[model samples]
Target: MPDLSLLDIVNLCDNCRVHQPDPVPSPYDSERLVPFYLSESPDSPVIGLLRPVIVEQLKLENQRSRDSGQRELWALNVDESNFVSRRNRPSGPSVSFRDWLDTHTKRTVAMKELCERWRDTLLFEDVCGPKKWREELYPVYADPFGVHDHPNTAAPGQATNFVFEMERSACALFGVVTYGVHMTIYDEVEVDGEKTLRVWVPTRALSKPTFPGMLDNTVAGGIGSGMSVFETLVKECMEEASIPEHVVRKYTRASGAVSYFYRTSKGWLQPEVEYVYELAIPAGVDPQLFEPRPSDGEVESFELLTHTETIRKMRQGLFKPNCALVLLNLYIRLGYVTPDDEPDYMKILTRLHGTFDFERW
Candidate 1:
């Protein structure tokens, strides 16, 4: 409900500047500053956690992509000039028609209809009509701009939650995208009288509808319709980690964010932005000693792993895809992983943060 969005996370970084032992240099030109640094290179691997076939779909919005300081967005297999092809512009005044209704437009026909509607519907060929789509998928489409206060959620001035569905959110078609927040609860550990690092990782509940028995961040949750980014972060910390409000308010730092356009194994177009955070536990509390009693049933258990162990699990693909990217980003910022360590470090960083149209938080 508040004006806060992931965009505000960029401002949180200003407070962190003085505390950073080795701060990344800020360029004289405002365009080059890193709220989260990213290169506007299409050839750069921006979409992590997706298969190569789906990743190749990332095409330049314009030949001048490298020239645009914002690198505003990355299109998937569509011409840049065309409005329908834009990745995150769902509310634009446009519509593509279809004889069959996989999902009907309740209030606005233009919004319910999409550019890649037919292409998206083909994957669900066995299913039919908007009513059927709702019956089957039961997607809780989210309003990216946080329209929670709007009295009539079903037909608010903005598009309803349906816009976030993969097919409905198709870049070259629907153009809407979703957002969330991810936080890594970390602390400095003393092993063998030497200083090291340890991170708290959560194993998702096996009963979870998606990615059961997988790994996740210390605390993570989606930024749903009408909820502000900070609100979601605080709420998730309490629910997921049982982290107290005082601790979260004092130690948590809004590090940065990552965005990506992914094609799920289930065949949906998922474009999302994840605002990242770092919460350092007090010296009196040991990460391993604390029990993460998940208030929500989403997490099965919690394990504290050292940096080496974390990377090993990452290589094995134990963590959920996006969570893995978030960890990799944390490692890079911590200087645990560097450009020299990987051949495509620069590209990895660019794609890891993603290309977003949103201005700096």
Candidate 2:
């Protein structure tokens, strides 16, 4: 098969932008998706986009919890509608999933309890089952906009303006946007009097729960609940690639970020933003010192591939989906892929930096 184009790679990550009409139209069926709100007020900001199945499950769980004399973690407000048309059509419930948790207990504790209960029960077994559960907690911001600017120095429950923290595994169930950091470590060398670029790429451990045995960025990991972007980058570098803190601080450059809404083959929503960074080993440095070795079991091994070979592997779909996007962004930034060569230059650039401004959706 021919190598995939840059546009094809972009489409792989930003796959869920198109809106599909509900086939069995109901009163709630319209252009907009069910928005998960931070509060009960109609004016509250939407923190997530809930799928139909997830919406139904949340409503059922809310009713069940209330019937059992337990505090309902979520409140369904059917009175207010966010639908485009108000022609006597009963709109879908505006779910205030975090408000009750925020009021009753510390959001951090409440969300943990809620997720633990769901994990124990049969609810969302496909995604939130014990086997699939990732014990790591991810923060949910009340206002996710401009959150990257804030330092990750806050405690578990005290991220800047964050509403709550949820289990990383269960985040897809709520369709919330998640944040992570991705870094590309590369080097430039002169071969046969010609300049050449080579990148350090790691193969994911086969034991990994997701995307096992696929190629990945040199250092990449999700920003845990209380960790900042750079902090996560540094931690993942050492943990995954055995790169030390001083090496990371000296070589890493904070590149721009990429955002995309992805739907898994299992039909789970993952709206994600990855803060991108690049670590370039300066010329004349001993390659052995900056070389990546698998420190943690997360990476099976590391390989340094030439620019042509790296793009070939990417085009062949060897890398994890989002990791490929990070590399694509790298190629563009380093001038390997440019407007003069790639036909869909503008389109590729636009999709890579998706606004993620859901109001227009």
Highest TM-score, which number? 2
- How high is the lDDT of residue 132 in model 2? 79
Candidate 2's TM-score: 0.88
lDDT tens digits by residue: candidate 2, 67-100: 9998776766544544322223235556775455
TM-score of each: 0.56, 0.88
After aligning candidate 2 to the native by TM-score, how far in Å is the CA of 318 from where it should be? 0.8
Task: Please state the error at residue 350 of candidate 2 in Å.
Answer: 0.9
lDDT of each: 0.52, 0.77
Q: Model 1, 309: alpha-carbon shift in Å?
A: 0.8
Residue by residue across 122-239, what tens digits does model 1's lDDT show? 6333322233232211122333434333223465465443432233233222223456789988777778997777888999998764578988999998765446678888888888
lDDT of 2: 0.77
lDDT of 2 at 98: 47
